[model samples]
Target chain A: MHPIAEPSLLLNTSICKANITKMAARIRGWQGDFRPHFKTHQSAKIGQWFRDAGVERITVSSFKMAHYFAQHGWKDITVALTCTPIHTAAINQLAATINLNILIEDVASIQALEDHLENPVGVFIKADTGYNRTGIDAEDFITLKKILAHLKDTKKLIFIGFLTHAGNTYHARNMAQIKKVVDPALEKMLALKTFLRKEFPLMELSWGDTPSCSIYNDFYGINEYRPGNFVFYDYTQVQIGSCSMNDVAVCMAAPVLATHPQRNEIVVHAGAIHLSKEYIQLPNGNISYGKVVKINHALEWDTHDIIGEVKSLSQEHGVISANKKIFAHIQPGDILGIIPVHSCLTAHLMKHFLTTEGNFIEMMK
Target chain B: MHPIAEPSLLLNTSICKANITKMAARIRGWQGDFRPHFKTHQSAKIGQWFRDAGVERITVSSFKMAHYFAQHGWKDITVALTCTPIHTAAINQLAATINLNILIEDVASIQALEDHLENPVGVFIKADTGYNRTGIDAEDFITLKKILAHLKDTKKLIFIGFLTHAGNTYHARNMAQIKKVVDPALEKMLALKTFLRKEFPLMELSWGDTPSCSIYNDFYGINEYRPGNFVFYDYTQVQIGSCSMNDVAVCMAAPVLATHPQRNEIVVHAGAIHLSKEYIQLPNGNISYGKVVKINHALEWDTHDIIGEVKSLSQEHGVISANKKIFAHIQPGDILGIIPVHSCLTAHLMKHFLTTEGNFIEMMK
Candidate 1:
């Protein structure tokens, strides 16, 4: 197929294997357990890559996703989101077979899990060190103490450790800024562990976020790692200095629908529906949806190769402001590769993927 | 079976039927052809409703969508996007069977169509009245003359009329701004039509944009009207004064996973991936992704009745900022209805829909 007049998400497995290998080597040097979050890819075939890279455990966002991957031979998993009462049955069903871990924030969630669970599952108290989206405030040890006391009575719950995600690191501008978020969060995790060690003696700390996990080499206070986006680091991570340009494994290949030589722009078929609406604010203050790249006949891209920037996007149209030289080569029936701003959302919107070797990879919806 | 942890796109048929009836009645009195855009709903079952309401024609955004509706008994359709060289085989395949109309913007597109088209397909020259997204500049009669000269030599093309969409009406703040965009576009359209009609005496004009078609009652110079988002107008249309709150037919029913009563916020499972990440700024300067409405036991929402606003969103989490009174009642296992900021993109993001009557409607992918 031409892949023009439509958008196709192209995956380079060779680059993806390199990314996986790089992350696996980093975790091995850190001497910590590698449990990459499966929410980023949500594909059984990609999960197999991690398994082959010696990643024994995994993390997912939903119990339904946990079920989907468990069916594909993932024996250990963590439903990373807050376990709610609505997911009681699905959680209990998965807990019966796998070494499932669930995040518990409030005592009510603990009570619901205690009343409904069929088998014992490891429970981690979600602590909010900084990015206060959700979770128990790390400063409020009283709430954690109460939840821990309540967990003592539950037969089906094993109070294991604390979990936190430095999602604020996504907004960091550089290396100094990323460590400003990672250092404090690690300090808070160790502080929380120190207080709990007096009572329980053995408590693990699990920190998961791509920026911190990719930049920081030392995980001295952390026990387990669960960074998802490193498998296909996007332009966001690249801008924040979390990963270099070579780490990005996925890019959108959209067909050129029209070329405006006077405007020096190329109109591509990929829009917000194909590439997600999330954008990266360049240092020059220009908002870019994605970075345009030239693809060879084999659909391989050199990320450092400068082409153009996707300037604006609407529902089904992406306007690329390229130079006259770049615009001269493109016509109505050409496909231009775009390194997406955020790979996770783009991959999710594109439910199916085509590998460079001409294979279709289907993700769990 | 329980849609508590995943986002569910909920459709209220009564409200949708009312919207369909209102548009159909308005178009009947206009004395022009009513070709409703099927890109909003994308469901064969919803197309049946338009068929039942006496809509003899339709407009779709892509050739694949046209093929879907053509299979479902849509005989008259306009593929309203720019027809590129890559879509020749599919367009010819479609033109062979139905009264297909495709948009042509440049002379290059015309020559390509002239070469590859197997059967005659009606062609509309896309004219830029106001929105300069795609189309020939309406004032550039030189390009139109060249295209017409080229079309005269073609064998398998029918030069029908000028087509346009006043897409800038979406960014209007009020009715006055909408009219500011609508009136001039109509003036230029008439000017273009008058210039073209001197040679082609039976020339027509086609205009389609939800705001323009909904607010303006006069279609004196237009022979065809094609509006899509009026089928399920969202908060953006409501903000622009094209439709009231009562006119919106579709709202997303998302699950409440957690609540922060102290902060007066609720964490929802619906996020940018589910709701398409489109936002509408409130009068108070707060950004809202969607309007929250109370859901009854049957998951139906009264469009006028709103409880709170979805304040912010990440990839998998939407934070709803509500009052203490609203937060006091919600728990971890509740479903809330959200009237999306943009219905067209939201509907396209959700692959399927569930009506209030518990019927599942599958859209064309």
Candidate 2:
């Protein structure tokens, strides 16, 4: 049965495949490992596409997600979120079956793992480098040394390397700005590695973010890259030049359900439930949370311009004010394509996706 | 297995139960039937609570959801979204087993549904009130009458009555504004019913929306009231006065992972993944997308007054600016409770809820 309207979620297979190729080439060029984050495109179908394009290792935000991808036969995995004491058993259980890498920042977390973990675990010491969310401060060498000293003899813990998210790329205004934030951070990590060589000569500097990963001409000290959103860049990435407008792999196809003459707006089937509320700061400082793209034949969308600004959103309806020129042509029953402000959140909200041909593609399943 | 941190979800069981009681009381006092919309608190546990509180019917946003609730023993269900051709089989399957109600705004949809349906399906005409979304225009009585006239002899189609979703309440500034928009719309529906009753004697008027359903004192012509968010009011509802701050039943319980003085902020585990991007416009027109609330032992949160505005959020972390006087008291590792700006999308993103006591309260399963 044909739906009265098109599904709000849409994923272009051709564009997705092209994105995978581009990300794989970038990783290969840098001589870095490609462990794409599963959180961006939680679909196993998308994961399979990644695997088919030669991606063997993967990263996920949660242990449950690791298990989700693992069930689909993914062998190597990294749970990127900090391991909580509550999830120790689940992690151990997962490790007993696959090569699982987990991240930790504090000694207390390590102690917690030591007390309860039953399986040997690959541990990555998370380093703080300006993102400042969940990592040990790089300048705090004493703290790092203390953690290394304690883990040296622990049979259950295998120190893998050091990991940094380099999330400041998200706030960067341009390529120069991204290099300004990431280059010094990479230098600091390399310096720390040199100073600690006598104690741990095998530490790897793992760093990744789509903005930095996509633009960097050099990976001087990085051993691994984890650019998840590169597979499906959104409005924010477009503004930062991380991905060209044509490179965005996913477009939410929403039906224009209502047009408000007074507001010069059209209501769409897509809302917060479909496209997440992540916003990009407009030049005027007001936010353009998302942009209306033009969905093409292959389900690929032309996202060169912002057709509509998501002025307000409810659960099931996104209130879009069509740009002056576009408003004149739009009406109820037409479809509008949207590129989310943040691809990660938008992908997470859509538990599954629909291909151009209308097949129900389950990404997580 | 224990997670390194608590999951970023919280369902206030006590507050949820209280919300149920209050909605039930209001419906009873207003002499209207309570058919709570399941889209907000999608949990079967919460739905069962409503059933136990004497609600015999409920509303869902999609057919997939209607089936989910039906499997949980909800016999009478309404799929409030516009009917489409693709969902006809599912709707027919559901109608065969339960008292299923569907909505349509145009003649083509009704014709498509009639062509594909095998069982008698209950249908309602979705009317376009002041909100101006999917519903057909009120002046199009000839079109509606033509639709009703066409369906008269179709054995598979059962014309029930007229249904209207006063979605304009989302734009209202407060309770006064919501009442101002909803009262007249309700009157319009009543007037339409009176006109239609002369030709079709068994017409019923069904109304949905938390703001319209909760604040209004009277429902003179409405037969059934369907309010979803009142089960778990969020920051938007608190501002609308449909429910008080203490009445909010669910929130995102994020861990304060790091404090960055350099950035003048603290990061939490919750982000757009947990809290959908629904926002509340402040009196000054600045937007507060989501608010940080207080999570107490009984799983009930304090009123919206305890709110600390979350200025900005990312995919994995939300940066709450400590620039405010109140945020200065917060420290790293404390849990920051967040009341989502829109509860509907946030509730839907969470596959299930976790109680304060750490039980997996599956919303679907």
Candidate 3:
């Protein structure tokens, strides 16, 4: 096996396929479109795995991401973030060929789309269920309906549906807490869907966040499932009761640079710029940047005998406060694999993946 | 001005040059090496700015960075992080030409260097004062002296000096607190130097953390200055009284994608992926992702009249809770500049930079 000299994201392709297979099985049963958000993986090779599992549609976070996947033969895709006129050229270019869908919350974006769109495209009105980050507040369906009416009256603008990202579920403490956050949002969406059906009965509805989408099985009414993070579950997802450590498919392989037995801290080359600055506070009130797991020569990891927790990180160093016995076992040149707190940010930071099979999977630039 | 389509790191060349000039003047007066750490602004263009100000020696955080600067004609360079055997090949490769200096605390690295060094290299024994991250503790001079003695006997290894990074100053509440952190650490370094000089009389002493190096001018005993983050002082530096907002050299130009008047929040295209997850808690105990600043079309920013505080961030979105009037005035397509809480991580995350002059500067990849 090649030494994990510096911090590089590693993928276990078998585990990733298993994760995809499990999610696909659950999502396929969801009486709706299963357009997994591509923003998490952002790899065309991973998209092929999805395609092999019968997924033809996807959701992405930006125009650049959408364009990358579109060029790779994904015909149906949604740029899940709100549309901006600055990306009009790329939007127009992509809309001319494929089934492109965009999110719009305010009337300004609709106006921009109307002004600059060279080709007609489907649109999802981003209605806020409760995240409060974006989308028109779902409670304000009156204004949303008026906008929908305006869109219906516009030429060639396909008013597809209402979409949302229930991001509040990310902060949930447990499955029940996740349900508490997600149920109300789903209720609000259903209420809006029923009301909007009066004018446009065929309009669809979509909502997703990894915790709510992965753990909660009753996603019956939603027209689309857009959860992205489940593909590469991280420590945060494990904490949220969405996935176990075994299900996580990606881990950052960092070279151990130095070890301090006095402090019981292991310094690794992986840090904020590699694993990202995202962290989850452990039950003991200490923050863990990522979960550290030791792997055998075959690159198979057994988290049962965990080495340490990455307690903190600077720009280029991850400080791990480990068990002294475990610390004694580590050498300076050894590679420590860290299960990142948030896989999406880690993937974004790494920009590429080296699978256990030694194939390099490129991320969308 | 070109419309700001997405988040791009904007560098104010004039302010940066002024910062370089000011710091260089301070170091020049000290009559010691002015090897400002290049890990902050990993751009060749910014390195050129340092060169324009008569900086010849440089400190980098990694071997790749050292090579990049070497390619740009920086001859005397130090890789400030602890040495690991995995990087032996690159270390030998770079040591063959440039005056490459490396940090080491343990004997394993010495053995590795002895095995692979194709050319002689300078070595600094890293000592720990209080950060507890790396380096042998200052009081552990017995171990340090043994290593130094070994290096003295070894061929191709020049034992130069003792170095310490008082990184705890990063958490200081203010300038006085920063001094409280630095003064003791410096005293400890001085004491170590006094004791070590009895045997190794020619050894140098160095200590640095941007807050201490930038604010406290008394560098009577330190032989080298290695402050990296002063080049782009950010909100953290301003809060700690190390530098003012006017001295801040870089800001992230993020496109306003949407707004929520009710929540008094504006959403932008920049998020953790762009600005990094570093943050500062506001005086009110609210965690802010970054400091938001309003800027004119000329790309000039007035930090005194602050725009807003980035209250929260996700993978691809930053939520700014600004003055209601400012929030009210913002259009969907407008751009807001954000002063990152920690400029080093922000710069590392950005990967490339776009100057206000519309030139693209590549980061050291």
Put down candidate 2 lDDT per residue, B45-145, tens digits, no spaces: 88889988999999998777898999989999998876655466777789989998887665665677788787877888888767776676655678778
Best by DockQ: 3
* lDDT for position A263 in model 2: 55
Q: Top TM-score: which candidate number?
A: 3
- The residue-by-residue lDDT of candidate 1 on A44-150, one tens digit each, is 99998998998889999877789999999999999988877777888889988899998888777789878988999999888888987878888888888999999
The deviation in Å at residue A36 for candidate 1 is 0.9
Query: iRMS for all predictions?
Result: 1.7, 3.7, 1.4
| TM-score of candidate 3 chain B vs. the reference | 0.97
lDDT of 3 by residue, A46-111 (tens): 999999999999999888888899889989989887877776777888899899998877776677
DockQ of the candidate models in sequence: 0.64, 0.35, 0.75
How good is chain A of candidate 2, measured by TM-score? Answer: 0.94
Q: Could you give the candidate ranking by DockQ, starting with the highest?
A: 3, 1, 2
C-alpha RMSD in Å of predicted model 1 compared with the true structure: 1.9
User: Candidate 3 chain B: worst 10 consecutive residues by lDDT?
Assistant: B148-157
For model 3 the local lDDT of residue B226 reads: 87
Assess each prediction's global lDDT (C-alpha) against the native.
0.85, 0.76, 0.85
For all candidates, the clash counts are 0, 17, 0
